[model samples]
Target: MARLELENLTKHYGGQATVRGVTLDIPDGEFLVLLGPSGCGKTTTLRMIAGFIEPSGGSVRLGGQDITHRPPWRRNTGMVFQSYALFPHMTVAQNVAFGLEMRKIGRAEREARALEALRMVRLDGLADRLPRQMSGGQQQRVALARALAIRPDVLLLDEPLSNLDAKLREEVRIEIRQLQQQLGLTAIMVTHDQEEALTVADRLVVMAEGEIRQIGSQQDLYERPADRFVAGFVGRSTVITGQVREPGLFESAGGLRLRCQGATAPGAASLVLRPEAIHLDPPPDEHNRLEGEVTFASYLGPVLELHLRLSAEDRITVHLPNRGGAGLIRAGDRVSIGWPQDTGIVFAGTA
Candidate 1:
């Protein structure tokens, strides 16, 4: 395990920068995720760290050692791609032992290590089977085991679970997290899936257009996003356009008054409220309430996601835990939705 750092890293393509200056520090044995939409430069940054791509500027360091110019094989970094890049002709044990074999490890030692790696992924009994003989989830486990067998200093995963079915993805995510923690390996993963990043990473770096928007714990990003992009990108958020009505109050374009508990640097701003924070009820003379009509509703098993359209303003979606409010709300229902002034966050409006 090693501490990784990216200092003022940048990459350019055809005269336009794809990865603008990015700087981050990942502590030893930490699980860090680079999350964003496609073409956000997350995978590019990972490739730079792996020496698959050279950066236009800045440096990459491992355990305080400069490794910006090292080749992928020389960097001692293990990588698992989205496609489980296993050898179809080889059995699981042979696939895992390939790396050790390349390093000229003794045959007996390589076999022993390969078995250990297979056991770590709970696939010891399947070592004799070829990759085609296994399911998608099983092939994924084999890919992971192969990466671990090399015992690299840092583990890099590029959307490792994107190919699996939903149930298998969840199961494999838990397994991967457990194995990383147990081995105390430093790991970095890149994914566009918000749930995967939130569930697997100790910290997340949200990026857009090659620039980092914010980096923090999952709870921190969800509860206190630095800006509108982070708020919308990290999870479901309702944006209310408003100017600072006063130090702690805001008036929406639709004439809805909201009290934002989270303070912002003084300026024209907007308030972003999480769906779970807003309460829906009949009209009440409350300090912060907005009346709206439910325009659409969908039951999401655990939660009912309702789209509420405020008079003359943008529609917002609110998620209600279906278990509690399953029979309470419906489409076209008149409702008052609002959060305490202090429950929402005020962010600077982009010019």
Candidate 2:
């Protein structure tokens, strides 16, 4: 295992910047995830770390050694691509041993290491099978085992679960997380899926437009976002553009007055409300309340997602537990929703 560091890492294409001054420290044995939408530079950053793409400026360090200009083969890093990237003609064992062969290891020791790596991913029984004969999930494991066979100092995954079906993706992700932990591997993954990042990462870095937005744990990003962008991206939220008249008073753009809690100075600001924090038919003592008609209701097993329109321009989303019969709500139904004053997160600026 190794600690990885990127200092003022930057990349430019022509005159446009792809990654701008990204600096981070990932301790040994940590599972760090880079999360953002498409064209957000997450993959570019990962490729830089893997030495597949050279940066325009800055440096990459592994275990305190500078490797900014090292070739991919000499970096001692394992990479699992989005597509399994397996050789169709090679059997599982041969594929896993390819890295060892590249390093000029003897045949007998290469075979032993290949077998052990396959065993780690629970694919030893299928060593002789070609990737064509295995399912997508199994093929993914083969790729993982191949990377592990070389005993790399760091593991890098680039949207490694994007090709699998929903159920299989969940299963394979759990297995990957478990295997990484068991080996104490330092891993970095780049992905756009919020749930996947939340599931496997010790810390998450959210980026946009070649710049980082926030770096925090799953709980911190969800409960206390640094800005409206983080709040809207890390999870579901209802963002209201409004102005703070005072410390605890706010007025919405649609002419609705509300009592809210925040230390934001009186100015143009926004209120972020989590779907799960709002309540239906709230008690009279609740500090924040709204009357709206249900615009839509979606039943999603354990919870129901509701879209409520308080006015022509002001709408909000709420999630309620799906208890049977009377608790069920539908579209076009009038309802009163409220939450505690402290439940809303207030941030300066309307955008």
Q: What is the TM-score of each candidate against the true structure?
A: 0.94, 0.98
Candidate models: Cα lDDT each: 0.88, 0.92
Give the Å shift of residue 285 in candidate 2: 1.0
Indicate which candidate wins on lDDT.
2
lDDT of 1 by residue, 139-171 (tens): 999999999998988999999999999999999
lDDT for model 1, on a 0 to 1 scale? 0.88
lDDT of 2 by residue, 264-289 (tens): 59999888899999999899999987
After superposition, candidate 2 runs with Cα above 4 Å error: none
TM-score for candidate 2, residues paired by index: 0.98
TM accuracy, model 1: 0.94
What lDDT score goes with residue 351 in model 1?
38
Clashes (backbone N, CA, C under 3 Å), per candidate, total: 4, 0
